[model samples]
Target: MNKKIINKYTSDNQASNLPDYQQCYQHFKWPSVTTQLNIAYQAIDSHLNTSNENKIALRWLGKQNQCVDFTYRDLAEQTSRFASVLNTLGLESGSRIFSLAGRLPLLYIAALGTLKAGCVFTPLFSAFGPEPIRSRMEIGEANVLVTTMSLYRKKVAKWWQELPHLKAILLIDGAGVLDDGCYALSKLMENANAGLPCVKTSPDDMALLHFTSGTTGKPKGVVHVHQAVVAHKSSAYYALDLHATDIYWCTADPGWVTGTTYGIIAPLCLGATMIVDEAEFEVERWYQILDQQQVNVWYSAPTAIRMLMKAGNEIRTKYDLSHLRFIASVGEPLNPEAVVWSERVLGLPFHDNWWQTETGAIMIANYASMPIKPGAMGLPLPGIEAGIVKRTNKESEQATLEVLSEANQIGELALKQGWPSMFRGYLHQNEKYQHCFTQGWYLSGDLAYRDEQGYYWFVGRADDLIKSSGHLIGPFEVESALMEHEDVIEVGVIGIPDDIAGEVVKAYVTLKSGVIPSEQLQKQLKGFARKKLGAAVAPKEIVFRQNLPKTRSGKIMRRLLKARELGLPQGDISTLESDEQ
Candidate 1:
């Protein structure tokens, strides 16, 4: 076997100084599985008759100042009602229902309901504008949609007749009665009272249809099986170290995998209560929620963590956050410096985890209550086999995939093929599905290296490699260099095409509190990064902004920046923010 790509992180794992992180945040320790439903359904069936039925499952807070809570029993009943309602609208097993909402309790009800009743539940970015909403509705063949009346009026009302697949629109509101064109969700729930039965299906049964940003090209549909849901239970509880009673909150919106897995599926599978606040990140409000709610296991992205870091520890210190046990970051890797700052200021090291939409849920992460390294994304979950594929020194192409067996060499991240939660296939795109893997190994289009002790460190994305004037610069290295500065809160380094240098590195930054965007600070940072990283890798330009365009999960959209600069059509502005960047 080609050991270079095979054990990409093994060398780095061996070199890591954090021994505790090596043991607790380890990989490949769980039982093997082949399905998503087996895990989720088992939880529902086994617990349905038990007294644990009344345990709290969800606590939702809408963006418009609304609150609702549910127990397992309530979930069962609501899901059943959701099943009956959707079925009445003529949708059956294998049909599709699209839910367009952030982190609403109803969205969960509709999703689990659709699964039990044998329909594919597809949730899109709730922040997506009308165009994306219409496009997805058409492509997914989604006939039935559940959304608020406002979303209908703002997005779908004008396009209703134009949608050939969309037959009915259900409206949910703070208060409303059931009607023909629009059925009031509250009254509909009152009508369909009892619990619904789950369909007798194997792990291979289609459970969800997720749409991934066709960054490689066009948007494509990804199908996930029933067994994928159950696989997430272990991935969430074990890898995330989430507990049964912990008031957990993973800050991703329902549109993303992180939201569904951590925010809904995993928490419900473990019978843990979750806080679903449909609010964006506001420094004071976030701290207030963490303090007021006494949240225990808190999971957010590194981008958000970096923003909080820039917000200054002084604001966070005012709140009594003693209830929090595990503070974790996902979506993006946490920098070592930010991790140290979190430990020093927040009294906890923010654990990092890694996963892709194609993986269905988290494949690697620092487990709850486990030893953690601030910079590493942690080991693969119990049964996952991950390694690095090195670049060969052939005087020809971009890096060739080298399967590694040792530690400390940079390589393309690859996972052992055939995990239970692995995506079934891209919807209607067989060739595209097979293209993601090679020799039975799923190539995660990311770069990572292993240390002496088995921890995986994230490098930038495959396409994020910066080439400037015959020298290649890794954006993360430059971004990390800038992050060390006290004035810098967050930064994204992009390679802007230039006539002279081929491509010049431009850094877009968001600064810390009390730090004004001045010529003095700009020079100070440029000089600091030149010293930290070599002069060749230092950014040539700095564009300071209050924010950078990021996905709902807190990933900086570098493509958006590149697209805007090239004057190309901007794709997927759902998560982009102009004011932030």
Candidate 2:
């Protein structure tokens, strides 16, 4: 694709007129009927024919300071070998493949190679305990599993027999594995052919399966087709401002949708060099990597940003980050404090975006060329039609939708149904999938409002909204307001049972280091909240905490906190990051 044609689909990095939903779709160049449109082919194989063949595709940094580089040609050959290995195992094209490892080179190979082989690929976060990993593998009906020996022993070996459909287990990191049809990944790759061609599949063919947590019961398995790559490529270009020469770093784990889309697919499809770090989050280490790697674009989560804010600004002076041009945050609503703090300290304010595991790609984002509203989620992507809508009837299963025309009216953020990346279905839950849509729009399950300038402002999850007295309150507003306090490090807000109001706002706070938690300080914080937010909306109860419950992905689990506080069932503690007493 030429620069002009690519920019026609992926909008230019300039504040220009964005095409409508239909126009954006029409601009994309879909593959011919006879041709295969594998994501691996787009990301790796296609680049081999051009000058990008020898370009650095991935730069991996190991825990012990070891480093490795994978060129586009190297990636193509390695992935082909992986695909050939799968073929030798007598596995069918449509089989399900799962990768349950850290951000290692083998895991990346499995992700791309599995898709290139016309198999559906699912990624499980390595931090997940045994139960969570087993549950996801079970739900996805994983046929082939690619993981390290350590993870297999700790997380999979115990329940390996439970999954009857599991065929082969490829140990990517260790030797001496032959039980239960398991084999060494390196040996298999070495023995297999490296000249295997990419599988030919239709646009509607299953490509990826991603699991998202539900408020109750088991996680929902979101299914996406090969056609979704069109959206992934375009969204990355427009939202991230990714260029062929830019070096990018996406800190999200590859198991998450953001990591799969932006971290693996988008950057590579655009021929950008990606930096992958296996080390855990450390403020100084992250800064050093950014400075040393010369990362032009950085994609990360809000929790990491909050952690950096707690690390203080003086530490930043030790490193040079002049090469960093753009930064973005996802996974949750980034509070206004982070935006301002970044601008003051890092010289670049983080642009927050909104999307879901179901959407598969970024739906709304603050463009590099556009003016940013500190807390807004920016405008809808070129191909997305977003609106604030309310269900006509809550009690009915087939409830219809009514789009709210007024600006700043809190309602469910809904999207029109024609986006290429819109999820096809929730696996084995057809009824549940149908419930996600009302009339024509896809109900995002997120409560938000749009201002006159077309910026979407997040409120909170619909079920997470707190009703106190006669007013509807979103926990994010209270939490953001509380975060502005100098002594506050992190905070979570939940609605507790109140005699008169039915429910009242309660705040659990973690103080900054050396900040004493005293009655006088509590009173001071209460007054601070009251000053920022009106009496009715400000937190009525304040409790001290060393930390609050959070998901591994950095989202505060408000429901878990409320459940624990009320002595209720703590459903699914699988993804809990920090369990504070």
Candidate 3:
């Protein structure tokens, strides 16, 4: 077996959506549609009039060994009832409805129903504290909030009155008794008619509002239109290898963009059976679910992969994962070691893909039919045009973007301006939206380089790039190199101010289980990294940490690490999942 490439067509038994990348890319065509297109209609209602209406659309597994299934017909009726309930409340089209709940059946219903009613749906992480929840609700001007009783009392009860635009609070699980403006969704659903027609919405109508936190300012409300479902359906077919009959599991919370795009919309729109787990990450439980559910396609993040790696490979043989055919990773650039480890132990390699909240769908991915390059972000999707470009001018208005022609040259990753899933704008920030575009390309703010074979490799974010002695270095390179060590499980790299070298590379590492941190071990790891990345590019200082700061979406907070190291203010920590002391 070759170490560099994971062959797609290992035998005649293997099958994929795109058997040939170039041929598929050249002949791809989006289906023509009428002017009125509702995402909810595309996902559910269209299936109602077909034989697929009885097929299971969602199979939700509760934390306590409970299972509930909803078919396409069931979902259509339930979501229609919810839409009728919204209409009864006098919430008109385009009303913003925010949901702050876990992986409950009602949350999914509310999301689809909002789109069915032509209202905008926004999801907030259930783990978020009061401040983060309040800030987002205020910014988005949430008109209706759907949540559980405990979440309402703990996070929203105190400040619900503060937001003037908040008209009602719909509790998903509650008895007859309610607050002043609170209504029980169960009772409302019982009374609502299930035959309510889906509102006619134009393709450009806003359907989803997703909040992404920045390093400094407040979270930006990214606006995605209903037309994004086109890209969502197509990308899932090409990127995720999703099919109508496959049982898929996407281990992402609906609050994040990945969960919404892939976890909810893409699967349903493609008529795939989706598995939703209510429990958090547990290695034993994950293995059991994979074995029992017979999940054919799995989508997850790099953080969960590292955690699984940390759990030891011996635990893997305890269960049968033979049903898993395709595995894809997103949320962050997957380290090359994880990809290789998955193939070695799990019998299949993970295909890593790259996209963001702004892009709203997968842009570049290692297709199901393509050979996997362990660390490279594979070719652009069929209708997408991506390039590595540099800005000639600093000013927003006068900036002249030039795509780099040479391979292995680092520059900003830019995409052509008109993908359907591309965010329409940052809700209230027009100037920030305008600044994102230059010369018909959307500047992605991420720095990367393309190899001679047309595979794109991620360097760090432009802001996270380090310059030492006039040499530019990406933290991902150092981190990936260090990850090759046997004992190292996770690594976060940053650049600290240095007297002579301008900015010097520093790394914070977390070792495997039972490995005690010592000066000798630290020195050994430092020597290993230096040997791998050279003296100048390797870390000048190495720190052993128990945990590194990270966002809920599993991205290491490099900016937060730099801020804490320099005693600078830690700004906008609303999306932070964990912190290191």
- In terms of TM-score, the best-performing candidate is 3
The local distance difference test score of each candidate is 0.73, 0.83, 0.87
Tens digits of per-residue lDDT, candidate 3, 143-256, equal 999999998987789889889999999999967778899999999999998989899999999999998754345668999999999999999999999999899999989877
lDDT-based ranking: 3, 2, 1
Candidate 2 residues lying further than 4 Å off, grouped into runs, are 1-35, 464-581
In terms of lDDT, model 3 sits at: 0.87
lDDT by residue (241-328, candidate 2, tens digit) is 8999999999988877777899899999999999999988888899999999989999988778888888999999998989999999
Off by over 4 Å in 3: 1-19, 32-34, 464-581
Query: Could you tell which candidate, 1 or 3, scores higher by TM-score?
Result: 3
Alpha-carbon TM-score of each model against the true structure: 0.73, 0.77, 0.80
Positional deviation of 118 in candidate 2, in angstroms? 0.6
Model 1 worst lDDT run, 10 consecutive residues: 5-14
Candidate 2 weakest ten by summed lDDT = 5-14
Cα lDDT for residue 472, model 1? 39
For candidate 2, the per-residue lDDT at 337 reads 71
